[model samples]
Target: MDGPFANRGRRWPNVTVAIIALWTCASPALSQQVSLPPPLASNHATDPPLAEAMQRIEQLEQTVFELQQRQNGGLIEAEAPICFDAPTAELPTHYPIYDSGWTLRPYDAAKTPFELTIGLHNQFRYTGFSRDEATTIDAAGNVNTIPNRNDFDVNRGRLVFSGYALDKDLGFYANIDYSTVASSSIQPLLGWISFRHNDALTLYMGLGKVPGTWEWQQTSRYTMGADRTLATTFFRPSITAGMWGIGKLGDSLSYTVFVGNGLNTLTLRSSDLDTNFVYSALAWWEPLGEFGVGFSDQEHHDNLAIRVGHGLTQTKNDSTSTDQSGAEQTVVRLSDGTRLVEPNALAPGVTVNAFDVWLYTAHLGLKKQGYSFSSEVFMRWLRNIEGTGGTSLESLLDNGFYIQGGAFVIPKKLELFVRGSAVTGDFGTGSEVAAGLNWHLFDKRSARFTLDVTDIRDSPAEQSRTGYVAGESGTLLRAQLWTFF
Candidate 1:
């Protein structure tokens, strides 16, 4: 019994010590030691939070990249998928109605169907004559001659306006000249309105150029020389009031048909004596292609073209005496107011019946690189030259031909050319040879300088009819400065 008590006492002391140690470990104020486990290996599947965070960062990075691309002009890779569904705004349609190369145009031309363009054309010329005076002796021993003077003058000063109105289908043009001519102070060169159905068909009405020879149809501003050929000046009527139809047949062919008042007449009202009318038709086929508008001899195309055409007119004469001005009335007059022939030439107070006029023309042109060539032949016939109720007279016949060629010595800047022309008619025969150089200061040929020398040979009868004395044949030196704006 004494041994059991002693063991219990010792066990009690050990228990007390163990309890103290446990208390110390459990006390809040006592510093405690903690052990951490080794870090788990990095793995996306194992760490869902980490993997989601990385995906969010990637999405943010892509957004920044797209925003940057859009800020820099909306440039995006073609293969990239589209990110937006918004529709793009459409732009308004715009069309050009006129050539942009024109020097002047309305400010609103590009935005509207209505447009207006203004242009100016001027030609300054100096002419020197070799023979200042000519003399002629008649059968009655009467000597007739006039002094010919050299001239430095303005050949042409014109204003041009053109455009489309209402729509492109309706086009119009007006060309006015302030220069004086034989019988007029102010001239209306062309004033017309056109209804264009298409390139294949169009109709024109007003005062305009007649559908005559190609040379006659060419604009004065574009002629190769300072003056038109003698054939054109003598034969072609300057202008007419008319209705015309022009159409293109396929790509290389064209046609023109017109009905007009008598040639070169400005009267808008019917006159008792001037009841005659003119009708014309022309057709041209260009085996290679169409030629350009101007005759520059500077090779504007790269192909060859040929044109043939025929024209006819019917006219009547009523006046046979002097007018209120005491000047004799004539059917045909030269540019210098010289009478060539009239019904009165046969006899005083003689009136002719209706006469038929016919004209035929053929032309050939070649343009290749810097080389150019052109030639034309023309023939005219006048039937029924006798007076009314009188015996028949011989029909009048006239013929003319011209050949020209040139090469651009410096491409478009300079050109040298030579031309020869001849005309034969009931009056007589005349020939001319000319050589010239053209200096194109502006590439568009809007500004040019030309110098030429011409030698003329004419029969005495021809000179007489042209108001020159019988023995008028010599050289002419001409210089011209021309500009178009």
Candidate 2:
């Protein structure tokens, strides 16, 4: 076991030596020079000496204070600099900026002056027709009968690619269809390039849809029903190579003009120099605000919106005849059997002349909350229509009209729609009614399923012994799936 003095020597050695150095010093200057010895062991006989040492230490306390004061300012500074090296780290390489549901963008998209994005739209449809039977009486009191037949087929399959380039100043769209009932091959739908000068003006050129009425210009993918109304189908030009200009005059006004190959012709250049050219123009105005394209009531506007529009298309056809007949004759005829011209019956050489056709259209649209409604009327006139013997055709006029509307029953998820169309002309009078329900599975009309039923009635003059129907009345049912990505 260690004694108390040995414990003190271990625990308080530095303190005891510091006290002894101060006590043995005689003057303030000598106190700085004094050296302290290590602590010593103690015994009972040495208690008197330890007591003397403690008394001497008490007396030298004042001297130790003076010695500290006499020394230079007591300050210590680091002899060298210190530094720290942290571990190296890397930053993320990829970053995203904008996501507008229809476009892809990069981290620096705002700064980028040019970009291109790819997209696709697809629709698969099945249509079924119901048979009908009808009886007709002729002028001689003869009883004639006609019968309709049922038919079903895939209607459309389209793939599209669209994007903006050159800092969005230039835009491009292209599409092709794989479903063809008349021909077993693919078909080109639309391919166009546009140059946008500003928000108010844009120029387009290529094989694309013609600019006519709202129903004609609106994309089929976004229509409320499974298909467009029969009035629009009969009057609207399908596709053509053309140059079109579209622009906004203000927040509430817009206009469009197009000059192209005549009526649904897709030829880049006409083989016949005398072929006709088609010209179309349209102007629209909004009273309460902008009424957008498409028939669905997806916007649910807070205020009532109204749009009114007018459009016109004019064309002149010129065809040459090589017939050797020495009498006036009709060498060219429209698909509807309208004679192009009455040639000089007495002349023995080729003859050529031009005829004119004019189309006029007016439309209106209204929308509020989850309800949308629209209507359009069309009139067509053919000039200089003559029979083979130069006999003038009577009342070479045609007219068509349609009204359509839709309401979202479940906000954006479910919708109900109805449409009716009527046409009157030399080919006879025909009418149709269509009703449908649209179930939006994803984003509005971007992904949807639809069911539609349509009924048609026609006069005897409109009956054709063609592909499907041979009667004056019929019904059709359709189901469709549409999507975009």
Candidate 3:
């Protein structure tokens, strides 16, 4: 009985002590912790819930990220993609029109405008011939003595004025040539009026003395000893043709056509007889890209000249003239019929009525990196020139050809060129070799130095008879200082 009471009293005391300890420590709810989202601010309690603040913070972070992405060149939310730099171009912007973008207003016909562009050009040339001494047969069938070794001294100076009408529709350009070579006088080189139509077409009406080949971009072909070619010197007409036209047709084609007095016959006079009208046409075809073929023709009352040239090969065909003689024979009596002749009739001096002639030219060029090498050949034939009697067409019919080559290298502000040319025809055979250096200073202005030699090949008797550069076959040399402004 005593042990039972002792046990009860001990259990009651332990229960009382456990209750006291719990009350002194803390409440059970208070001891448990609640985890809230990341703190919105350092001054606020992080143990509580703040849903609205946390949502706002999340939105702000997203906005910042989006702005950064856009600044770094990213696609925007509602915009098209963009590039920083654009692509480069490869082709030219505009096509080149031969004589375009230079038209003045107020088109007038009679009252022509004038622009004076004056400059001086000069050159010196020496020609040598081989020595030949022979006897000549006169009209009386008599033989005569001859001299040898003749040379010629030549000098040239020119003033040029070329421009367009300032307030009119007409265009005029002229050059006055002063030289010791030919009849010394200021001769007009180019004077024409261009009628404007559109961007690609033009009509030129006036005097035309320009050579068929002198209009090429390369000036070397035309600048032969301050003139053009020897063939042009001998066979070309003066200001006898008129009503010419030239135009650019397409991106790679151009043409020229004219109706003029081809029979005006080139002379040193300002006016001549209007013998007959001649028509000329030229067409250029660019088939191989940078290479072209040029076809030209001159038709006169009783004569015709057809020319064909190649841009790449620099070669031309000059076999247009054909024999017009028939299979027949005839007899002739001289004015002084002291002697009668029944020869083959196909004699050297017989004259025919009319014949066709062809001229061909070809060019071979090596162009690389601003350097150029080129050559040309020109040939012509007189198929027939028969008149009547023993005075046959042979004396009237003339055929000739020429060959030329040149090298243009070391291009800079100043350039150097060397060229050689030879001409052979019924008149005689002559050659020209030239070396030149030029300095380009400003617009259409340049200074140059040129040296050249010319040779004439003629029979001993023929040269002596002419009394020109007689019977000497060699080259004459010359030095010249030239300028064009």
Task: Find the candidate with the highest TM-score and give its number.
Answer: 1
After superposition, candidate 2 runs with Cα above 4 Å error: 1-114, 134-154, 182-184, 267-269, 272-274, 321-354, 386-395, 459-472
- lDDT of candidate 1 over 345-401, digit per residue (tens): 334554444345666777666666667777777776767655545545577777878
**Weakest 10 consecutive residues of candidate 1 by summed lDDT:** 320-329
Q: Report the lDDT of model 3 for residue 87.
A: 26
Residue 406 local lDDT, model 1: 74
Which ranges of candidate 1 are over 4 A from the true structure?
1-112, 136-146, 180-183, 267-269, 297-300, 303-344, 347-354, 388-392, 459-472
**What digit string (tens of lDDT, one per residue) describes model 3 on residues 342-438?**
2222343443433333333443433333344445555444444343442434522322333333333333334455555544543345444445544
Q: Give the TM-score of candidate 3.
A: 0.50
For model 3, the local distance difference test gives 0.38
Instruction: Report every candidate's CA lDDT.
Output: 0.59, 0.62, 0.38
State the lDDT at 385 in candidate 1: 58
In model 3, how large is the Cα lDDT of residue 314? 12
Backbone Cα, N, C clashes tallied per candidate: 0, 2, 33
Residue 368 of candidate 2: its Cα lDDT? 86
Error of 1 at 96 (Å): 13
- Residues 1-485, model 2: lDDT tens digits: 55766546443653575456545443434545665453454442356755565544543553443334323222112222211122111211123222323344322334444444445566667656654656643322334465544444445566666666656678887777666343534677788999999868899998876666678788777777876776666566556788999899878889999998766564334554345567999899997877876777687778898989999987765434532221111322222222234233112232334446787999988888889998999887767643343444443577889999998898878889999887776545667888999999974667889898888775222211112221246786778887766
